[model samples]
Target: MSFRKILVANRGEIATRVVRTARALGYRTVAVYSDADAQAPHARLADEAVCIGPPPAAQSYLSIPALLDAARRTGADAVHPGYGFLSERADFAAACAEAGLVFIGPPASAIEAMGDKAGAKRRMLAAGVPCAPGYLGSDDDSDERLLAEAERLGYPLLVKAVAGGGGRGMRLVHGTHELAGAIAGARREAESAFGDGRLMLERLIEHGRHIEIQVFADAHGHAVHLGERDCTAQRRRQKVIEEAPSPVVSAAMRERMGADAVAAALAVGYVGAGTVEFIVDAGLTHYFLEMNTRLQVEHPVTECITGFDLVEWQLRVAAGEPLSAWLPNGQADIRFSGHAIEARLYAEDPYDGFKPQTGRILHWQPAHATQAGRAPGAAASSVRIDDGIAEGGSVTPWYDAMVAKLIVHGRDRADAVRRLVAAIEDSPLLGVANNGRFLRDLLQHPDFAAARLTTTRLDEWAAAGAPLLQRPAPDDACWLAAAALAARGDVPTSAPAGLRPASVAWQTIALQCGSDTRRWRVRLAGDLVEFDGGPSVQLLGQEGHRWRLAIDGVTRELVALRHAGGWHLAHQGAGFVFTEPSAAPDQRRQADPGRAHAPVAGVVAQVLVKPGDAVSAGQPLVCVEAMKMEMWLNAQAGGTVRAVHIREREAVSAGALVVELDIDTVSTVI
Candidate 1:
């Protein structure tokens, strides 16, 4: 039953992850990609590669027939559907079985039973597992019926889509006034994302800790639990930081929870790696959430702590290898050691409501720099960066925003946090906005350090804003930028041969950053750049986005990247975007009096206001869709719409003008 070749039916870090282990075990690996990922790292790393379809997931990764076709064409004996896409799809699993291909996951019946949230809850109840009290009604349940169910369940419950993962189809309703709109919005988003609008109600656990147990099973009926991960640090219901061996889960509690998780797995007769999630309240009471029927995104931390490759276990179990062969004594003999933490590196702007960023990765120096030929002892202090994109790659708005997973292991929890912070600070990533600094700040936060975490921790910090936020770009950024500019031949060298060094013309350069403009006056004498005769500055050398600097008897490595005219600089955990002064129109300024521009790149989902229509301040003008989420563009001030430049279904780039408004005494038109 051993596989000769394994087709990784996925993309990004997870796909590359499977390929790495499969090839190591002497199995040839095949990778599938979309048009946007033709040059993706996973595609180029595999022994064989195939283009599935276009950028959109439906036309490619999520297509069952396409995946099966790829397996047949590549002569693959087995298919590994990495987490997401069709990993939990029962029909897809059954299709693989029918095609005489081994689906390296649970049986179709197990997936079918657990894929339905309500059905899984019913089974959990039957298996004596504690579950949150809620209404799991039938598909025919109408809006009125759902409203009634909410009334009975009480306010502040969750409106969750039964068939979808992520936060796509989730909404929080504190009262009945917002219940209807929440339901409608959740349904619409769920239908668009997962093709199923079915929903369920659950009691919202405020300030609760999200804990999940990793369970692995084999065809021989042997199952084992591999500790738990605390994923309470989240934003928008998606986990940002995950760590193995929850701080609150004592030995007694771990044993109880682990046993319950094992029961949940055995109840469904599940095989392969799965996660049983639960919500732990302040009083230490736990409630069953849902069971994921595939490998989890946070599985790396578990691997780092347990010293076992879960993906390898999946392959072995699928090849008819008994769990007893790997572990003679099963769950009882498994040992847990040390601590591990993983942070999700994403191409998103944390300052801007975590808006997804899409663009070219001008430079990418991963956390540990590279994954090849590293000495074994380096693993102790090194941060493991499981990344997917390269320096010249473009992160289009076609898939998940996650760029990599930064996992670090240490002798203990405090050591792990320290290493993680240092790793984030040393990471060289540029060209797109990210939350690396924010993650670093979170690791050092007093609450995080003291293990005082809950689901609402991120939300609380976001609401406080500025003072509580991560450190902003420091004043040293200017010094680094100036050094980079001087090194790039922006400074006059040797006084043009005619004039003496004293007669060299003084140069003044104006730089604009954000909303502020600053001017620097300097004169360059060969390698020395004199700033009003303050200090003789020398241009060392440039390495990627970083520059080695020697200023005022201090030598330091500064990160500075050149864009069009100015340089992007980062110091500590903060980043600053500096643009060189140019005569071109200022995009951030209100140059065109009444134009309303798009703040982010996305497709126009709806035009809320028509031309000549009056709009009030904060009124919805248009709705833009990007990365599977919809954002409403509201009017900044009350005005009358003069013209509409964008229509529904049209794609718009960031900063594109979408409307012209006539406000008070001014009216601008195109």
Candidate 2:
């Protein structure tokens, strides 16, 4: 099965990722993109590109007919379904085969066998692989039977979709009273996400780490495991950080897990790339999780440590090449060098329950300059940025919120963590609310440094209202910078570009960050500033989004980027957005808690209340779904519903009013 051209039937970073390897391997690549991704990096990186349909995935990326048409138009001989949309669909493999195109993945039978969570669990169990004790259902998945099975499996079990992965179509039931709702919600999500409402129950491993082994197989009956990837750093069951050669998995443990993962692959007669997931307890006992029968999103971490390209492996296997051709020593040749860590960069507000954010990327500069444990002028950087977004690009709500992936390699785990943290902190991603500061904070957290993270650790911190969720409050120096910026008066040089010793002196402004307000009056006369409540401030100079200043008698350099009529300042890993009420009033600066408003831009999934309906404080009144994540707009204060401004299925922008109640507005945290 030799193919000269490969069509990538996906978008974003994964599509670009596949195109990179295929191009490097001397195969011309074709990219099929939706209207939303016409100018996306993936579309531009391919040898040829085709516009499939409108932005809606059903008409574009997820449409098999559209993909086949694109392939035919480009005269492509192979199709590479980059993870996510239709990547795991067995029918897609069969369709590609029928269309006389090579699907760069395992056989259709393997995907079907593992696509269903229950079926995969049963198969793993039959293959002598230990599986989590659960009801791999026998067709009777009714609410009553599932509830009964939940009782037997015990409380705090996991309700999961039988046909999907990625924490979607999954719910955690902590008690008997929650089982029914969990079942219903999980089913709805499962149906929506995977078109499969079949449910399964698994006894929750109260304390465990998420571990997966990357396995590759070829048509010559050769299979090998590429070691383990620890994905335990997760929030809401979605992996945020992934690292190779898990900090926890010992050599012996890796052997056992790797062998089991390979067996799980061979059990299905799998060919190409696949990942067998597992959950390991403190006792070192591991249970089989479902196997993903395609290349994984975190495959780069495996590649970094092993010095092998998994995508290239996929291409070779799809072309019917034997493993011996690429891996002269098979499993023995697979080796780990140094440590590597990857953190997902998402376009979301970490301070606001991690709400997904959508807007254009006014500025996009990652911290590629941060050399890892080397000289400042190191010739090469160990940092690798797997990003699909570009400056001036729009992060539409129509797709996943992840904008880029930051992966770093170092001599050790500590070195890698340090480099990654530096990369995240120095990266300036403006325009939309992002998770850069939050990622840095998480990386610097003592718990993460000590490797004390569990699957639910982030959730637990959030539930406890830990300060980890809040943005770092501005200090005196920060405030001085903000005030100086407001007073800088970015006008003609005659007025003062930025404290250029001009005749114009006195400037007073009211700056606000969140609920904290500060009234500052700066009288700049001949290099002397009347700032502070006297905290210390002196604008040394300004250079296009950068400022050198003396604050509190100490010289410091900071980034002050202006976007959307607001000032965005950054230093170290802290960022604060400030707005002047006298000029452009920020909608969020004084938000009304009694009114119903969307925290993000998304289609209204449901409206739980109507006009004149009585509601209690904290009761969910509306549901908004974006990028497959749901956010509930809850009543901040109990009162009679005065009006419902937005209805179900309506699309709304961030801070768009949805409902209002007849009550005095109360201050509430978003």
lDDT of every model, 2 decimals:
0.81, 0.83
Q: Which model scores highest in lDDT? A: 2
Candidate 1 residue lDDT tens string, 1-670: 6778999999998988888888878899999999989999999999999999987787899988899999999999899999888998899999999999999999999999998888999999999999999998796768888899999999779898888776778887889999998898788777767788888899888788999999999988879899999998887678889998998889999999999999999998989999999999998888999999999999888887777878888999999998998798888667777888888888887877788888888767764533411211214444677888898888877778888878888878999899888888877567778888888888998888888888877877777784446445447446534643643354333335444234356786566667566666777665556666455455566565666666654667767766666577766655677766666775675555467788678777778889889877677788777776677777766778999999986778888999888875542322
RMSD to the true structure for each prediction, in A, is: 3.9, 4.3
List runs of model 2 lying over 4 Å from the truth. Answer: 369-380, 491-501, 523-544, 547-555, 583-595, 607-621, 634-650, 656-670
Off by over 4 Å in 1: 367-382, 477-484, 487-505, 533-536, 582-598, 603-622, 635-652, 656-670
Indicate the worst ten consecutive residues by lDDT in candidate 1. Answer: 369-378
How much RMSD separates candidate 1 from the native structure? 3.9
